[model samples]
Structures are given as C-alpha cells and as structure tokens.
Target: MLTIKGKLGIEDFYRIIFKEEAILINKDVLTTVENSFNFLSQFSQNKIIYGVNTGFGPMAQYKINDSDRIQLQYNLIRSHASGTGNLIPEQYVKAAMLARLNTLSLGHSGVHISVIELMTSLINKNITPVIFEHGGVGASGDLVQLAHIALVLIGEGEVFYKGERRPTEEVFKLENLKPITITLREGLALINGTSVMTGIGLINTINTRKLLDWMICCSSAINEIVQAYDDHLSLELNQSKKHKGQQQIAKSMRHHLKDSTLTRKREHHLYNGNNEVTIFEEKVQEYYSLRCVPQILGPVLDTLNNVEKILIEEVNSANDNPIVDVEKEHVYHGGNFHGDYVSLEMDKLKLIVTKMSMLAERQLNYLLNPNLNNILPPFVNLGTLGLNFGMQGVQFTATSTTAENQMLSNPMYVHSIPNNNDNQDIVSMGTNAANITKKVIENTFEVLAIETITIVQAIEYLKVQDKISSKTKKMYDDIRNLVPPISDKDVPMYPYVNKVKNFILNFEEEIYACKELN
Candidate 1:
C-alpha cells in the first residue's frame, strides 16, 4: 500500500498506477483540507469568485445565488464531460486520478475531506473512470478529459469496475460506494490542473528510461555482429569530449563488449602485410550507425534525464488556479495550470525517440543488405536464394514504421489553435504531445524488435555464435527462446515480430535476474 500525503514522487506514482496499490491520506493533510473548507464557508454567498459563486471561462462575470451554486457545479461537470476519442488506457486514467488526488491533498483547493476520501476510495477499489483521449487543449487544465473523471464522482458517468464497463451509479451500488455532492469550488478544483498531461508524461518517462537501456544493449550486439572497432568506445577518447552521457555510454559499451572475440582493435586488421610497400587493405572502420552509437544516443540520454526532472516537479506541484492560502487567508488567482513545461518536454522527447528509431532502422538495414553487411547473405536468407526473401518484408515494415514515427515527431507545442471563445487564446497541446509520444515509443519498440531478431539471425548464419560476448550471448539466447531463428522455409513475420516485441518489453526482468547481461 502507498500513502499519499500531498508529496508524492514519480516512483511512488508509478507503483500506484501500475501496481494497483491501495492509498491512504495523511491525517495532517485531512486537517489542512478541512481548514481551507472552513475558510471558504465564511465568505458571503454573493462573493463573485471564479467557478465558486460565478461562472467559468468567459462567463466568469455572471454571479450565482447560493441555491444555484450546487447545480452550477453539477452542470459544469456534465457540460464539460464531452471527451470523444477512444477510452484512455486504464493505467493512464488511474495515473490521472492519483495526480489529481495528490494535488488536492496540498489542502489549497477549498475541497471537503470527503472529496479526497472518495477519490482515494475509487483508486483503492479499482474503480477507474472511463476517460477519453481527446478534447483537451492542455490549457485551462485538461478540462474535458478531467471532467469525465469528475462526472464519475457524482455518479453521472461510466466507470470500469471489476473488468466490466458499467454506469457509475450501478458500480457504486454494487460495491457499497456512495457518490459525494460537489460543494463550493470542489468541481472546478477537480478539473482545473495538468494532471492528465502530467500523468501520461510521467508514465512515458519511466518506460522510456527502460527502453534506452534496451537500445544500448541492442547496439552492443549489433557492434559485435558487424565486427566494429572498439577504439571509438575507449574511455580515454570519450573523456576528451567531456560529456557525461557520452562517457557513460562509452563505459557501458566497453563493459558490454568485454570478453568478446568479435570486437577488434584498429591495429588487428590495419595492414595487409608487414612489407613496407604493402597497401592498407581491409575495411578499416564501420558505418556511422555502429561507430557513433555513443555520440548519437548520448544526447537522448541527457534529454531523458532532463525530462524526468521536469515531470517530477510538475507532478508534485500545486497546479490549480485560484489557490487558497489558509495561513495568509488569501485566495490568489493565477495561471499555475498551464502545461507548457510538460508540452515542450514531451515534444522534445518524441523527437529524441524518433532519432533513436532512425538509428535502429539504419542498423537493421546494415544487417540485411549483402553489400553493407560484408559477406552476409542477401536479407540474411538462410534458405534457397530466390525462393525465400528472408527479412526483406520485415525490414520494409521497420522502415515504414520509422517513417510514421518521423511524421508524428513534429513539435506539438508550436501548433496550438485558439479555442474556448478565445479565453484560452494561447494553449498547450501537452496531452496530444504525450499521446503521440506513446505511439512513437511503441513504434520504436517494434523497430528495435526487428533489429534484435535480425542480429540474432546474422550471428546464426555466420556460425560464430560462440564468439559473441557473454552479454550478447545471454540476450541472443533470450530472443531465440521466444522465437526460432529464420530458416530455409519462409513464414509469416507478424507473429514473430510481435513475440520479439514482447520479449523486448520484458527484457528488463531478464537483466535484473542476471546483473551482467543488461
């Protein structure tokens, strides 16, 4: 079980979302929440505060009586529950809920303690709101997406309960749960934040970190199969550049290639003969794809590091507008809910991931083409030459997928369109950026899968499996365990590709079980 006390970290959020851990609110946070509620109750009913006694957005000037405030909150939730895309994955919904709950726990949203308890109970009971994927401009706090969640709190929307989709009221009755009434600014507080975008970004950051490690492992295997020179990965040479990511990658490459007979030093094949007149024959160096692994992937590592920090701070921040200060007795209205920070970071992340996919595709090309592969059979076809196309179609799929990733890599931060009656004249498409980034990550995984299977096939064709490094040997064996190597007979590639992708997804566990293999 995890305890949310208004100060949740990224890792804790990960566990709560992915591991389905039950949550408990800190008693101190509950006291602070009650204090804010009491402070708000002291205000006269005619006070014209945004989303409390007055209307929202451009209609903020319209005042409401005490009798209609409750109805106004309900109407705000129902009217804004207009999300239209496919249902968001349950994990993301759960993450959004946790983020929203964490922000409210800060005790500045002027919400009653029962509101927080109800949200926490939804998480503990595995009752996830069916949030949609569209309708968020990422400004004014993911309004549409979050309103879908807010609707469920009042038993007005659908929810997923025990793996079945049902009305929130039916689920509440089945689980002995009761919906709470929204009071004062509670409805606005629930939807007015960056939780949707922040939750998606946070989850992707964690997964991308694992994917980076796996990409390095794949690059190491490709280097050994292509007989890359190890001088470029020398610690001394990398230290001259003075980049932490480059130096770290160089070190990791050395460790990955340690005890491998296939990786050659530059001098081993430098000269054709000892005679002074002899020509310097033999391919002295590898292609940039294999030689510049650290240089190309180094910046991606740094970007991931930077993005993770921003997401951590965003998740832990009080991103709601009109923050209530109990100690100062003030209601300060501000734009803390803008998602530009996450939008820009996610856009950068997608571009970096697209470059990684491009690199993987180049390596895959090198492994399949006969001329580039240096004596490897065309398409690494082990079967009858003309009859079997061997990884030919597979490479094409990878190429096309990488192209799609490139198309999706355009920065979303710069493409904001005005909406919401121009009240939100400038918007942050943070959620759109994050959603497409998830697709890019998935596509990159498929590209890496193609590369992994192709590398294993090359090692098998060369009959040099025994010469691979111990780390590559483990990884190669793991791949083979999932799907057999390409043989003389041609077969459908989708099933095999999917199996390898799943293997890549679960590769982290294999590395954990064997510390030296990653």
Candidate 2:
C-alpha cells in the first residue's frame, strides 16, 4: 500500500505511482479535512466563498444563491470537462488521480468523505478516468484536465473499464458504485490544484533519476574498455570540490569498476611474465566523457534530488484557494493553489536532462570517432569502411535527438503570458514544463539507446583479449538479441532502433534481471 504522511515527498509518490498494485494511504489528511470543515462552519456563515458560494475565476464576483450552490459544484465539474486532445496515458491519469486524492486528504478543501472514498475506489478497482494532455495553464490549477478526473468521480465522463473506454455511469453501475455528490467546497477542491503538473513532473523525475544511474553505469563501462585512470574518480578529489552528486557518482563508478580485469593493472607486467613492462605512450588524461563523467553529471543529480524534495511537499499540500483552517475558525483566501514552486523545479529538471543528453551524445560521438575512439575502427564497422556503412547513421540519429532535447530544455516558466483577463498575471505554466520535461527525458532515453547499441557493436569488434566484464558481456548479448549485429546489407536501421527502445520501455525488469545474472 502507498502511504502518505502529511509530508509527501517526491520519492514516495514516484514509488506509489510506478507500483501496479495501486493502493494509497494519507494518514494525516482526515485531520486536515476536519480542520477545514470546522473553519467553514464557524467562519463562512454569511460571506460568499469564491468557489464554494460564488462562481469560478473570470466570474468569481457573481454570487451563488443558497438554492444553487450544491448544483453549482456539479455544473462546474460537468462544464469544465471540456478537455479535447490526446488522452493522457493510463499511467499518468492514474497518477493524477492519486495526486488529487492526496491533495484532498489535506482537509483544507471541505470535500465530503464520500468523494475521497470514490477516488480510493477507482484506484483500488483500477477504474481509470480518461483525461487529455492539454488545456491546463498551471495557474488556475490544471482546471480543465482535472475536471475530466472529477467527472469520472461523479459518473459523468468516460473511464477505462476492463481495458476498454466506457461511460463512467455504466462502469459505476456495473461495479455497483454511485457517483459522489458534491457538497460545500467539494467541487472547488477537486479541480482547483496542480495535480496534473505534479503527476507529469513526478513521473519524469522517476524515469530521469533511473536514467542518470544508467548514464553512470555506461560511463563505468567505457572506463573499463579504455583502461582509463582512476585518479579522476578518487573520493578525496571529488570531496574537495564539495559536490554531493559528484561524490556519489564517483562512489558508484568506483564500485562498478572495482572488480573488472579489463581496467588498468598496477602490476604493469603480465601475471605469466610473458610481456615486458613499458611506460604508457598514450595521453595520461582521457577525453571529457571519461574524465569528466562525475563533474558534468553530478550537478544534475543534485538538482533532481532537490526537485524530488519539492514535489513531495507539493503533492501533500492543500493547494486550493479559500482554505478552511478549522483551528483558526476561518476560511482564508490565499495563493496556496499557485504552481510556481513546481514550475521552478520542473524547469531545473529539464535543464538537468539536457545536460545528461548532451553528455550521452558526446560519449556516443567518442565511440564512433576513429581518432578519439582509441583504435576502434571508424564507426566501429565490422569490415572495411565502405563495405559497411556502419554506425554512421546511428550516430547521426543521436546527434539529432540531443539537439532536439536542447531545444525543448528552454524553460517554460520564463515564458509566461497573462491570462484570465490578466487576473492571473503571473502564471506557472508548470504543466507545459512537465510535459516538455517528459519529452526531453524520452529523448534522452533514445540517445542512451543509440549509445548502448554503439558500445555493444564496438565491444563486438574489440573481441577483447582479456575477458570483458561479466556485466558488460551480458548487456552485449541482450542488445545483440534485440538488434542483431548489423551487416553490410542491413540497409535501414530504424527497425533496430525501434526494437532497442522497445526493450528499454517494455522489458525493464528483464534488462535488470540480466544485470543481476552478471
């Protein structure tokens, strides 16, 4: 079961979202909810609350008559379900639902218990709402996109039932479920927050963190192949710089390369005494990718770690305006609903992904360039240069993908256009940042895929005299199965590229299982 203490951190949400079982718990939410309810009863006796007793945004000043207040919540949800674009993937929709639930659990929104129970039911039964990926400004709190989620709760929108899209009413009827009736501040609470942006950002953070680990692993693989100097990764050297990420990276690389026989042997002479000892002739220092691995990627890790901290806090927060502070006996209007915090973090993460993509692109270039590649054949071709076109096209693909990532990394937070008639003058656009960050991370995956394939081919060409490291050998065989060795007549390489990406996307466990066998 996924657990939420009042302090919801990014790492926690990430684990819960990725786990297929889909159970979640917010232990402190009930208390927060009670606090909100008490405040509403004591302080909201006569005044019109923006969402609870009056209209939403552009029309907030309009008064909601007592007779129409409850119906207003339902109308608000049904009307706001105007999303029209590509459906958000089931995984992301599920994540949004979870984020919404955690937000409600904070108890400042005055949502009914039945509403929370309904959301929990959808998660437990795997009843996913159909939501689109567009139309959120991240200022009015992902309003339109989240409305789709709210519609499912009230049996008015479409839902994925038994792997097929069906009307929420039918799905609820079939499951003997009833639509949750909105009461008091329920409707406003449901849609007025940053769940959509948070969901995308959380998911991106999860994948990006793992990708960073793999980049380090790949760097270690390169070190083993080149027999590069270990002095660059020394803890003392990284510690003096005081970068936690660099230190952590150095530790991971050292651990991964610790037992490899392919690395430089300090003894200088062969164990059998067959070869004479000689001073090294190659440059003492390696290329940037090899020597600067920790330096370049460490800051990225630190940034991601900080983003995770912010996400967890945001996910657990009560972000709706006019929060009910029961202890204070007041419904306080505030800007807790703003997504500025998430927008900032998401931008930072995008920059981190850009750096990682650039680094991966550089490493792939090194493997393909004959001079810089340390005696590897041009493009690591299996035969004579022209006889096989080799990894030339694949390298081009990497370069293009990295360039695209750099383009997408332009911060979305910096390009704010006022909306809602300038009432929302300074917006977050965090949803845009989250969506673009996801694409950037996806692009990074493709670049890494290209790098992985290139390294596999290079290793195949090497046929190393000493046994290749067991970990690397397993990775080599795995890629070979997905994309068999390229021959002169292999013609186009897209199929091979697609297959490699599929392996990364769908068979992650199998990939890790192979790693374990090593």
Output the number of the lDDT-best candidate.
1
RMSD of each: 2.3, 3.9
Ten contiguous residues with the weakest lDDT in model 1: 509-518
- The regions of model 2 sitting more than 4 angstroms off are 3-11, 24-43, 265-281, 488-492, 505-518
- Which residue pairs come into collision in candidate 2? 8-312, 9-312, 10-312, 29-105, 32-107, 33-107, 35-326
lDDT of each: 0.85, 0.79
> Can you write out model 2's per-residue Cα lDDT over 406-465, one digit (the tens) per residue?
889888888788988888898888888888898888888888888888888777777762
Q: Work out the TM-score per prediction.
A: 0.95, 0.91
RMSD of 1: 2.3
Candidate 1 lDDT by residue in tens digits, 196-277: 9988888888777767777788888888877877899998789999778777777777888888899888766554455674
How many steric clashes does model 1 contain?
0
lDDT for 464 in candidate 1 is 78
Output the lDDT of residue 232, model 2. 86
Q: Over 4 Å off in model 1, which ranges?
A: 43-46, 271-281, 508-518
Candidate 2 Cα deviation (angstroms), residue 278: 16
TM-score of candidate 2 to 2 decimals? 0.91
